[model samples]
Target chain A: MKGISHFLAGVAAATFVPGVVESAAQGSYLIVLGGFFGLLPDTLDFKFARYFEHHINIDPDPANLDPQIIANAVAVEIDRAAETQRAVRVQLHNIPLGPNRWRQYRIRFDAERNEVVITIGPIVNAALAPLDESGQRVARAKTKAKIDYTYDGEMTADIWNGPSFAFVPKAHGVEVQFLPWHRAWSHSFTLAALLGLITGVLFGSLQAGLVAFLGMSAHVVEDQLGYLGSNLFWPITKGRSAGARLLHSGDAIPNFLAVWTALALILFNLDRFSAPVQNRDPLLTPWVYLGTTLIMPALILIGVYAWERRKDHVRREVAQQADIVAELKETEV
Target chain B: MLSVIPSIYLAAPDETSAFIVLPGQKWLLERRGYEAAILTGIGSLCGVIVLVLLSPFLTEVARTLRIILSPHFGWILATVTLFMLMSEWPKGGDRGPTNWARFRAAWSQLAAGLLTFFLSGLLGLILMYRSFAPVPVAFVNLLPAFIGLFAIPMVLTNLIMGTRVPLQHVGGSIDVSPALLLRGTFAGSLGGLFAAFFPVVTGGIGSFLAGHATAQRDERTFIISQGTSKLVYYAGGLLLFFLPGLQLARGGLASMVSTIYTPGTPQLYYTAVAALAVSGAVSFLLLIPYARFSVRFLARLDYRTVNLGTLIVIVALLLLTTGLSGLLIAIPATAIGLIPSFYGTRRMNCLGVLLLPITLNMAGVGPDIARLLGLA
Candidate 1:
């Protein structure tokens, strides 16, 4: 779920309780505070924890100067290192064009072919373009380069267990390193409880603390609905809990429904609190509210889900036809 | 005319409209422009009709509620407005750019959010302090805020961050199918009616709900619906103020009108409706030429230069309308406004500044907190 969806879920949970709305009218805006706390877990992970994680470096063999040659040699080295339970590294140099202009490249490891491929991307200019011989623009010109290398190492089985890589430019060369594990202690339930407790203590209210706890818990649970589950037990459990793969964070319909429902409920709660004393009649009757807040959203969700599924089906059919055509062409060749 | 200018600017910028129109609808606009336009026209016409029909009942409800809720009305309005602002906050995505670049972007966003927050707080304090006679018009401050927060940023971003505009086919006539036109109109009018009748509800929200509820299968229908919804939300909302037995002001434009000219007659209501129709038609005709000119102009010009010029114009306007004090308030408001984009959260959260303070006041704790902060 996106941040808005999670925030709204926490808000919806708080607003579901009529007491919270009533209390809001009486000078306690704990529900709003709860909504803020709901956004805290993700905020902490992305803004703070991400920076602290160490990058794993993979340095390529110094003998292989060309990226293509280095990629091939590194692939073989990785396989051997994985089998020996040792780390392998790679080093790629930035392709310099001028005083400050250069071409940066990225490396991708192809697991199926047991190979590595290098592709040069966009040009970066530190300053103004130097005129070419034709007196035309030179800085914006495209660079086209692609290289592939195969590996025939004995340790193909354990390559999957090895760390992922990100290429960063250093003075000597580009360093490829694995990014550290995310959604660990930062996403744990234990941390949420501790944070809530501390917050409550600071505010001098147990209820406030409990609201924080609930908000954080709601966020964790919502995340669990997606593919990237959080480390629920935290220190007690070292790994993430594999989530129910019903949807992804980027699924538009689910995200929309979550935000829409939350907002509607919040509005209903606000209307309840702000209504005049003499007119006790609710603006929306129970049935209407249910229809708008629950049933209607549910129906829309289903419609979107079905539409996406149909689109996926059509796309897959077309892709399969293309694959078949390509295979036939290969056979003919 | 007052609402039209800002509304057009807000709507004209593709960025905000991108949020309103679904992805599929944009594709439809590019491919089947005629169908899209027809659907939009039908939807808008239906929305206007619905607003006209519902004005009497909605006005009565609004009037009754206004009398009953008058004491805490300001607080409620302030709270909701804050929330609305927060919802508009932009988010920084995990992808694209290096850490340093991302950090700079985040810092700028934070600065903008903080500026908006403090400025809004200052405005609240001023309202609390004394009502200025010959008060600045409602949009005097709001227009600059919109331009600074929404317009300038969009223009700057498109200039700095965007790629060259690709050549696209633009000429087309309305040739929508009857079924699509009806469905689009019905859905749009329904949403527009909800916005027209409801408090704190805008056309954007209404159209969003309608789009989802109808599960519009095509981009053409969705685009049409959004078009109708916006018309109803803006023009229809204003028309409510002219209603005979229920001459109640609903939006900023209506409130300003009420401040200047009293509305009480059925004749005035009919006249206003006629005027709305005439202005809307004229605006629609003008939109085509203006949009075409803007596209051509923007494609050739350097975005950075345009952005710089826009920034200067906005600042000048802000100073002229609100003076030094308004500029001071705007500084903080701008910072707060920038937060949503930096944090990768919905800008709507900025609304918290108003919602939190005003809601607290309504609940009777606001004054105490203000005193604690020494604002009181």
Candidate 2:
């Protein structure tokens, strides 16, 4: 789930807390606490934790431009994780070639061949549009350990500081993880409750504490629907628990559904509790309005998304195929 | 009283919004501008239809929302401002001579983005506390500043880089499926409605929230959704102001119109709906030819010249409306606007101008800040 989804989920959750919405309608800022906490988990990871994580940095030299070196470097990390029964986090630095120019590369784990596949791709401009078709080659290095990675998509080290990964030693093999720093201690129910307790103590309002707990809990639960589940109990849980695997974290339909459903819930609560009964016509029956507006649309969109996803070869390589900078500029938010 | 065109115009790529521009620019470059623009227009039509169909029910929703959100607007605005600032990660800066260099380089871009936002926000604060544009032209006072912040930098960049608009293909038909359009419509409407309903939330932010929540990745779906969201936000926001008993004034159109007239009738509300549908059709009808004309024009002229002409026209207009004082405001704004491009930051940070000052005001600290800055 994205930031806005969690934010809205927190807001919707706040609406359900007794007296929150009524006070909100009457000029109280207590409910805003829900959104702040709801988004707090991700905010912590991306803003603070991302920097603090001790990563084995792999910065490729533009002058050298060798794929084999990169492949072997990654293979060593995987082997180390498995042999030592420890987790290893690796950060791949992109090769820069002057102003708005970069030598791009792709790294994908091959579970079938038991190799790390590395492809040094074309020299791309600011938009990740290839400057020329030249300067491209592929290299594969055999890994000592059989990798057990769930992610099928290739992590392209083009722009955006590339993607980060962690290799965890599992009983079966070395498990590969994308964005290893994310969804760790921050996205935890334990942390949520602790923060909630702090808020309650500070504000001396049980309502405030509940809003924080539930708002953060909503983010964790929503994330469970995605490919990667959050560490619900934080330090109590050794590693990230596997998700329900229902949808990709970046999938459009589920994100939309989450936002829409949350919104409908918010609206229903607002209309029901905020408006005076004497001045208002009866708000639509909750089930009827929700069924017509939210549930029906959710079903249709889900069906469409699922059907389209049948050809899901990593979103059919849309991001890779399209110009990266072009896409980023258009969707600046 | 129930005009939708104001919202529609407001929705156009401008200070607060204009999510359609970059996608539209890409399509125009690909020669599919015709189809893309047409599809977006259609997407907006769907948005209008949704707005009109839901007009009756929305009346109650609007009234209830105003009551619920009136008190909490301050922190809500503050949260959005905070999110907008915090989310942007370093685009690049992995390289430099040393660790400190690398750290500085990366943080530099981040700092530039933050600085851009804060600087623009300072400008916003100045404008809010003191006015140089005069009272009669108050409605258009922000126009010059907007043109400076958003428009001038791009024109200058194009001129400096010698960037050209690629020759476009005037394709006859758009490659769109009913399913895709429906998805776009659904996502876009969600965004537009969010923007229209929420105070201080613009169509761009709405589209962004909707896009993120919906995870629209496909190029076409993203474009169509943005188009729809913009229309729904602008027009839908205006429509709310005319909702008879509800009459919750929102958006620029509603704000401006409220000064002169007040609307309180079902007939007026319904008339606005009818007008929306009709005008939306007319806008779409013109989009096809307009896109085609643009393709032809770009094919002939040097894009540099086009940008040059644009700068001249913009500066001329600024001078005419705001006198020399507007140009003074523009100079600093243009400089602040360019920070994102030079520092490898998100241009969206430029929105800090409006978001920062407004958030301060809503939070009841605007006057204090103004006094602290000696603007008061």
| Candidate 1 per-residue lDDT over residues B1-376, each given as its tens digit | 1232223222222322332334333333233333334445555665555555655565565655454344334433443343333333222312224545544554454456555555555545444433231265544534444444444444554454442233323465555666456556655665675566555555666675455433333556666667777777777668877877666566678877888988887777777777766666666666555545544554576645655676688788767777775566555555555544343333333334334455556667668766776766
DockQ of candidate 1 relative to the true structure? 0.05
- Model 1 CA deviation exceeding 4 Å by range: A57-109, A124-182, A267-283, A310-333, B1-116, B119-233, B236-248, B260-286, B293-376
Best by TM-score: 2
Query: Which pairs, if any, clash in model 2?
Result: A252-B214, A255-B213, B13-B18, B31-B168, B31-B169
Q: What lDDT score is found at residue B9 in candidate 1? A: 26
lDDT of 2 by residue, B99-183 (tens): 5666676678788989999998898888877876777776676676687788898778767766644556667678877767877
Task: Give the C-alpha miss distance for residue A82 in model 1, angstroms.
Answer: 3.4
How far off is residue A75 in model 1, in Å?
5.6
Q: What is the lDDT of residue A226 in candidate 2?
A: 62
Clashes in candidate 2: how many? 5
Quote the B-chain TM-score, candidate 2.
0.88
